[model samples]
Target: MQPTDVSVSGIGTYHFVYKHDPQTGESGFSHLITPLGTYRTFSLFTSLGVERLTLVPWALEAGSQNAAVFTFDWETRVPPSGFFQGYPLARFTWPSGRRVNRLWAKRLVVYDNIQINWDKEDLLDSTSVELHDSVNEFNIEEKRQFGAGTLVTHVRGDLTLAGTKRPKPKRSGLLTYTYEYEYDLSFLVSGIRSCLYEPSTASPLWCHRAHIAFNSWSGYSISPLGANHFQDGLSSSLVLSQTGVQLNRRFDNSGRLLTFALQDSKRQEAIINVTFVYSVDSLLPSDMNLETIEDVPLRTHYRRGPGGRIEGIEYETVGSSRRRHVQVSYNEESRISDLRHYISDSQFAKAGSSESKHITTKFLYERGLLSGFGSWKYTFDEDGCLIERKLRDSGSIEDLFEYDAKGLLRWAERRVIPSTTSEGQQKTKLEEPFCNGLENACYPQEMGQVKDYAIQYLYDAEDRLVVLRNTLEIDDSIQFFYAHPQHRNRLTSFFHHGKGKAYFLTYEQQTGHLFTIEEVDLSAAADSNPERKVYIIITDTEGSPIALYSDDKVN
Candidate 1:
């Protein structure tokens, strides 16, 4: 009997055909399936993830720290034409954490909102090289019909803190918002609407989402983690014409994003338009521009070295433009040995003109190991662990970091530089040099003592950070205590005391997760300034809180 077509669910299922949009998705890459166009695959859907299915994403991108990646096996062959096909399967890169190069290979992505395909197979075989080296490839010039698939997203705040500045204990304070959505054939708001998100809305906030491009498709947010992983600076917005909100997206033959623009009810020009540029062999964008219809376009250009590593980037934008030129260098061992950043105005090109007011930051490394950044230098103990770090950016050691023998951090101090005054920023003339290798001393009059401005941390035998002490000003002592106040091997209590205000948290745990967290405000003397106790209650097995209540109100 011939193997018939059957739908499968979950991971690693058998006896079903894994096919790309069997007959749909955009034309170019989506339609091309296996190398032979008859191969089967054991495929699974993924987000920005690593190659190993059993492993979880170790770290997440908060902004543009790392690029977006989907279907990680793209470095070799093309994915079988299954649910999401057309993306270059062989363009996948397992990047190093530092973004040695900000190239198109890092954040290549294809959304199902565009063309999609699936692969089909009869069974799972351990001997199939097609499963390991299979990469999703693309074709050109295909028209596509899209659908607004199911999308779920929730974004919350970072609720749990370590020593001080305890977050609100209400479950409401922990969630920015939870979103559930669906759309018809075209991706539009099927039920609920999308909204704006304020940073301070939650403490230990959490965001979660599973789909893309809903009408309310405001921001690319929400993950199981309280982490921000979208492309840097992705925002939450509505597309309102004089009639209502509108969302639009366009893609080219290889499924690379051409533009993501929003139109509104007012019929004003598109509020936001993001365009991408790429090399033919790569699925990621080598250059990108994100801007409003009326604003000067902010652009990002990636530079690559002979090995395809990102050597530098030219970023033109506001706020972050000052630190635009990021250059990276490697050691003979091929590890990142140095990083340099030149801060200048957006108009300053990479010309070798002698008239550039570039604020240069140079990184320092010991051999191939990172030692410090810019004017910061360091000393290490015998064990190769970092010991002391001194920042001499302004001729004086503006900051110092010290660690214990076990590599635990012990002390950190930062000197506050006074602004230029009538004395012109406390100018000092030194006629005599310091003995041997001693550094010059320049302390502001505001600093009463040489060793006063610092913070200290203490850890337990188990290597858990347990205590923090602050001495920001002369004779002002602020301390916080952390202990396993409820369950063993768990620290649920954090008492913060400084200034005249204090915050205390009592974490409630069930099944090793936060169940309810209560917070109280206190006086400097620990007199316990009585504030209403805020409560966070979890109602699900995943420890997702459904309600956050405090003082007879649900927030």
Candidate 2:
């Protein structure tokens, strides 16, 4: 079964141990006896007396069924009490008792104590289970006070997905079983976070230890509960002698963040705080006030729609009479189409407001897409592709777009026309061409343009892009190479033109990921601090892209 976002269910197995009751001369359970099964209806046992395995509410709109089939050993075991009238398994099959090997999962339990496991475990030659949960229904382990045979059974098995077809721990001479499993959250609370109960009465209880969740694989240490868990080695809860920068926070009744105060951080200093306010129906911030951080007061207000979507934001500063505000409006397609700017400084009369005091700028869109910025509007082709854009105030400039049949951008052109007041419309046009179809845009371009030299694109019969270059200048082109030719996007190494500097694009042997160890020339390296040339990116194990440096900073 495919895992859905809502619910998870699993089937399980139970081994009922029984001993001979000397007084009754009958085999009865010494501890954790199975509930008596009565003949409820057609071929059905009434109550198998199981724990968990109940579907109520989200589990199953119907409460609890409290019934199941029995598994017993005809060779040595008693039949469930009062089941001769109910469903029939096999005539004379269990005249003595029932014999079943597998059962359904009785309950799901919250398991936060489970450690991360990427390593495969042998399913208990019988059964192995994967467990990691913040909150989940769990099986109730029934125990009798001082019951017989205190020996706890150690069920050894491989941890595997249920219903997996590999020989069960018993198939291969192993008896493999199959059961589909999917777990989902049941209840999410929004108030003073408290506990929630499982749908079934037999649901067991588990608690969260509240440990600071930090990864040990990375250079991070796990702190004890209640201890400060810090990122970048800065602590807000550490108490040192008479001084500590302990940050504290408070939440409203709706569990929404209300205030962030530095009062507790340094007790001797004046409290520096920021408070958030909201309407009764809004869980989102409506207003925010900052105090004690600067000499003057600073504040911001949020205007929201009936649906709770933020519509505008206004900012106010203590010393400045002028305030800034931004208002947003959505188009028919529910995408942001316009953003308006305004200043509240009483620079004009209330009649209509002065031009400078009113909308300073307005951004517009077409068909739910950004079409223009400030008095400009965009027009699209029949295929809903942007074809042209021009300013509403004046057609001083225009941008043109073209696309291939595959919906890939082929080229774009920008033309700046000289205003009538200037040098009579010289119309300077610049165009950019994009390679199509290939994942890496490997083919380069067709080499046909208003002004160009020769650009050669070489590839095998497989259509893989191998080489590209502009005969005009050696430093103005790019080249590609591959380790796995079939994977077009997987360029093992390539050469890039970094504004005159030739960069060798290669993979880090340790991570098999691409990096540009910009082979800078002496002219480029002449700049400051050579140490900054070495950039460190830590996406070694996980394939996550990182933008460590902002803008054109160092390497």
Candidate 3:
């Protein structure tokens, strides 16, 4: 037997396969399984024919086995004249167990009149499914000349389920389902054509009405759901028209209303309003853009404070788009002092009531560098470093600095008066020291209150730093070690914190460039996990060269 011919109401399983020519360089294939005592059906809708194959296994009674197969070639007829639509269809059933149905459609066509089959199972319910019409019955020509026409569809049933014990139900059940789709069409006209005809000059002379809807499960519900209206552009800026929402109440609830308001000016009057509603929450931001707020104009102003610091600032947008203004003020210590806002145009009259305060500042410079200023005086060493600082207010506060023979700041001690009346009483607040300048003068070598951390620098004959050693503050505490090239230009720096480990790094000699880094011998450690090894590679400007390659898995 042919693969397409499968016995109905039998105890066996059936398998079907289908193949077709590629469309847009892609093809689809599906496999279906039918259980025993049931029949299956397949359907498709397309302008092209389909090749199908089916396999059925015969019923086995008392150690008896048999196999059966069938194949079939099906094609849909082309359209006669105006609109043409097609889909693939199939169905199957076994004894009294289960039944399967399927249908496939490619492109949907629309014309003056068209009919669709709803029983076609290949039509999957999806958000992308839509029905469109070319010539709407509500157009001006149809209303003024031909009058309204009827659009309907007739659906057929599955033959296998027709006379069976439990026949398939009607296509449209009691509760109807409505689906509404909305779209806009616009065309631009030349200036010369627009000048001759006032409507033509308006660019988009038509604006579609909102709240049009459609229902598919109601057998056939037709009205202005597929309607189009023309508009004049001379004196009107916006046009509103609608369809289908009137026939189905559910359609009214599911449909959307759109408003097309137009404003055209010679300079900057063109505007478009987009309203999107989802459930009970809505978002609206007026005149917002990528950079600035177009709905409000902003004026800039600056306020001065002690030591030339900004104390207060205000932004005024009077006679602006929203008639709103804002002001902010700060105190002598650069703290926010006051803030005020006005929403009405008349409130701007109170802007003159803003208050201002005056502050005084004194300067104390050592070798042209600010050592200490304010209500006090300070002095520094010859190298332009703060050696002593004195605060001359109610109480006395002083800080003394000391340097090593190598001219590096070694230590500093601070002294403050115990109380306002006890001018002679002093107490030490803090004491810290520095060992050497390794990385740079700004980043010292020895740092911390306990002098537990120290760093040593090795320089070449030319005084160029070649290598650096970082040590812990405790005696004989060596955290880790690093080595650098003697040539300063070829030297590279790296940082690591660990114990009993060697880290390796590759660098370019000529450019002093770092190429790669690898941990030398920690792979066998108890904490090592194979998956923890990470590899990183660096590329050049053109992404061509492997400038660096680092891996944590090393031994």
Best by lDDT: 1
Candidates ranked by TM-score: 1, 2, 3
What is the RMSD, in Å, between candidate 3 and the native fold over all Cα?
A: 39.8
Question: Across residues 1-555, which tens digit of lDDT does each residue of candidate 1 receive?
Answer: 434332232111223332446464411111112211222223344445322111122112223333322224432233444434454443232222111111123322222111212121211111111111012121111111223321222211122223233344311111122233444455433332222122355322212122323223223321211111122223223222222434454556665556655444455776555667777776656777766545566888877654456777777774453435666775443445565544454334555432233334455544223566655676643333455655454434355676543346767776645434333334432122211211212111222333436877654323445445664532233323222212225543444433332333332111344533435444322233455243434222233443343332334
Task: List TM-scores for all candidates, in order.
Answer: 0.34, 0.33, 0.20
lDDT of each: 0.38, 0.36, 0.28
1-555 in candidate 2: lDDT tens per residue?
322122111111222444565795654332221122112121212234422111111111124453232222121122333423322222121111222222112222111222112111111111224333122221111111111222112211111111212232211111111111111132211111111111231321111111123333322221221223222322122211122333344555566656654433424653455667888877777887766533566788889874666678887886766667778775433345566665655544464653233443444543234556665677865344677766566565566665432234434565555556544222222133432221222121222343424444433212335344454554444434332211325553333432323232333322345432323231232333222121222121133433221122311
TM-score of 3: 0.20
Q: RMSDs, each prediction?
A: 21.8, 24.7, 39.8
**Model 3, span 1-555: residue lDDT tens:** 326334333223356545455664423333344432222234333334443444333222223443223323233432222222332323333322122333334333222232122222222212122322222211100000111221111111111111112222211111111111222131111010000001112221111111322223222211222222222222112111221111000111333222222222221432322222223321211121111113333343344433334333344453543232234454322334344433333333466522222222434332234544444566754333467756556434566665422234434555544454432332222122321221111112121232222344322212233223332321221111112212224322221222222233333222333433333332233333322211222322122233222221111
Listed per model in order, the count of residue pairs whose N, CA or C atoms clash below 3 Å is 72, 36, 42
For model 1, give the RMSD to the true fold.
Answer: 21.8
Candidate ranking (lDDT, best to worst): 1, 2, 3
Off by over 4 Å in 1: 1-258, 262-267, 306-308, 316-327, 335-362, 393-395, 402-411, 416-555
Error of 1 at 273 (Å): 2.4
Better of 2 and 3 by lDDT: 2
Candidate 2 off by > 4 Å: 1-283, 288-298, 329-340, 346-357, 360-374, 402-412, 420-529, 533-555
